[model samples]
Target: MSSSSPHLWSPVRWAENGSVRLAFDQLTEQRDGEPLLLATGLGVNRLWVPDGLCRMLAAQGFAVARYDQRDGGESTHLPPTTTRNPITALFAKRGEAYTAEDMADDAAAVMDALEWHSAHLLGISLGGAVAQRVALRHPDRVRTLTSMAAVPGDATGLRTMRYIRLRTLAKFARLKFPDTPEGAVAAGIAASRLLASPNRPLDEQAVREAAERNVDSGVHDQQAQSRQIGAQWHGPPISAIARPTLVLHGEDDPLIKPGAGKAIASRVRGARLVLLPGVGHELPERAWHAVTTEIREHATSAHHPPAPPAR
Candidate 1:
């Protein structure tokens, strides 16, 4: 594949796990960089992880790689079912597709493809929830964990609802965009606007080109989103996430409240929580420095333990 502006991604690669094929790509070369895998929100492709953010992480000695989860982007799309409403499927008694454990394995499969024995994990929104499950299910595969704008993996149904803002949830139903490529960009911007911090002006240009390239992202496909969210997590709870964990949430997040981050930080022993003032579900340019710095410091601390106290 050819290179593009803002997003300096390498050639797209395919990683397969049984019937599912995941699409992934790496940032610029960093031979000695630490392995960092990023995961995005519901029904989003790897492109959802902002190019600037990935570049900054890469510049900070992290070999970054992002992939599309099953049923999103260029990855495998499972068969549709009667489940259409994401909210209903979220609290359903049984999964209509696969278990959350399967999604966790999907992340591992990508790591295997990249030849990484283990890597640091960063996830946002629904991706953050998946990352938590990944940490719980494959503890040995995760070195450090960062979950942003997400609820606890173990929380389901009413428990999960406690952290969600219903007013913002209702807004998703009202968003309508055209069926063209331009429409895709518009929809992406609209969603970002909904999740962006009101304190900062929404920069549509920041994500327009990337969204254009990732037009195939099934963001509007509620059926696929239902299957993804409906997949139940029967694995260990967040308490079992023993990796060095960092929980971050936007103080002004319109969709998932900051309490979700608090829940994760509280349940995971020694987890550090950072609440970003005027930040929201979407990572705005203003937050780039703070977010990357926190991750860099957290990862560094994880790898290099504090010197033993001198007597």
Candidate 2:
């Protein structure tokens, strides 16, 4: 096992109920520093994220933690009633339900379990939406926020004409992922080619290994994916959020257009928006260096804001 892997952070029970048990993994030596929670995107296996990225974030000097959101890979899966038909429960006032709010609570519950009064919040795609909700719902617990490649909410509509290239879609559709880890690794390589940056050649072997590791942890649940989409669909508007925020999005994201990012940055007062040219929905390996640098600077500067100008 690698020294900086979230595996070494060890799993701690984050929350539980009659249905599921959620947990978070630590990726650094100190849990007491400004805690940075890394929430994965929709339908993404928590382990699917490259270990090197997590390690680099931890090594950047924040106490890093990551976790499987409820019903995602390696997290407790819910019953068919909820996971399969999440839309029905969107407005239902009930316990043990999974909405975007509930998902944000799951992240906050992890924070609560850690006894962290507040921490840096960062997320990807759908997780980026979750980060916004976290700052909205549990504002006290979020010291700073970094939302990447996600829309604010339904308030900002995606353009009607946006669509992925058919060749790219065909490549993904043709990918036949096997049940075994080896085949999953191959599948990852295929998907990487489909979603990778147009500016660089895909790293076939590294993505394959990352895919295999994620497969070893667990397969992504289609039903859970249903719940995650429902949550994003019914999520609250975030225009009024007052947290110090960094909004990063690919200039050419076809799934959720760059306008969504612009809308979000416009909504959140003082949000810094960084447009990655020649990028897309996927956070390719090449983007990590710039992505992480912005996050590190954003979080660190939150601690040392400039003095008030002469009054």
Candidate 3:
């Protein structure tokens, strides 16, 4: 229950319909007597949330937990690469692929495994997609929902061709480089360069530190990340969500454009959208206060007590 550092709560092996055993890294901490579950984005392990966010949320008296998605971090990898096109893999055909619904089911399964009937859900990027699906499909399992830097399955709201080309290039670079230290360094630089705001002073040490942490977290299967992305891209629409939702996006996001967030807000009735200027794709320290504040406020507001008799 301590907030000083991440504590290994337990390991969960969730069996899906196909008997696929998905592994997850579950970190739990108590805050304000409520439990908060964080589902991370693609290509990242449980460490996707920065330490500052962990401490801040824990300080707010909510128990926080984060897990690695299937095919990423320490979870089970799919198989050796066969497809050369990342975009094609992301938009896979029917029965032969996984979808965001599967990922959302995985999250719900994790919560059920932990015996939590409901928990606040927070997701970033691809993780946000899963969270949305979860809230939509299993509204009773989510007390509150927050999607950061995410889209609502609207391909038109994505970045321009130039940015897509840049991301494709980065994907190729990652495929070529894999998990080498040099590749990690290069990937970190590329991510920072692509996601950082020009007005804000860049912190080289922090970037390097983040890179090191990503590397040291252990090797990830590139194929799994690819598959997860593919599934999310072809997942269900976001119009089914009924949970009180909050969508946070940077006004200057270079990767997933702000239009995506706006689209999501428009689809989900009563979903609040908070757009911060000068922020980028990655969750920088400067935007931490606002991001966490909004999440806490939204979640707290949604946690309503039983209504008294009509008067």
- For 1-311, candidate 1 gives per-residue lDDT tens digits of 01134446778898998899999888875746999999878887777776777778988889999898998888999998788878888789878888888899999999999999999999988999999999998999999999999999888877888999988888886766676777767777667778888777766675565566667436667778899888888877899889999999999999998999999999999899999988989777678888999999999999897898999
Instruction: For each of the candidates, give the backbone clash count.
Output: 0, 0, 6
Best to worst by TM-score, what's the order? 1, 3, 2
TM-score of each prediction: 0.93, 0.80, 0.82
Question: Clashes in model 1: which pairs?
Answer: none
* C-alpha local distance difference test of each model: 0.85, 0.67, 0.67
lDDT for each residue of candidate 3 in 1-311, tens digit (9 for 90 to 100): 00123254444545343444555444455633576778776666666567677667776766776766776655655654554344555444531346666777888777775668899988887788778888877889999889987766323223222223355336444544557776765565555666666567778877776676565222233455657666633444677678899999888776777887888899888899999888977777778788888988898778773477999
Give stretches of model 3 more than 4 Å off.
Answer: 1-18, 21-28, 95-97, 153-175, 216-222, 232-236, 305-311
lDDT of 2: 0.67
**Worst 10 contiguous positions by lDDT, candidate 2:** 155-164
Total clashes for model 2: 0
Shift in Å, residue 160, candidate 2? 9.7
Q: List runs of model 2 lying over 4 Å from the truth.
A: 1-7, 17-19, 81-97, 154-187, 216-220, 232-236, 252-254, 307-311
Candidate 3, run of 10 with poorest lDDT: 154-163
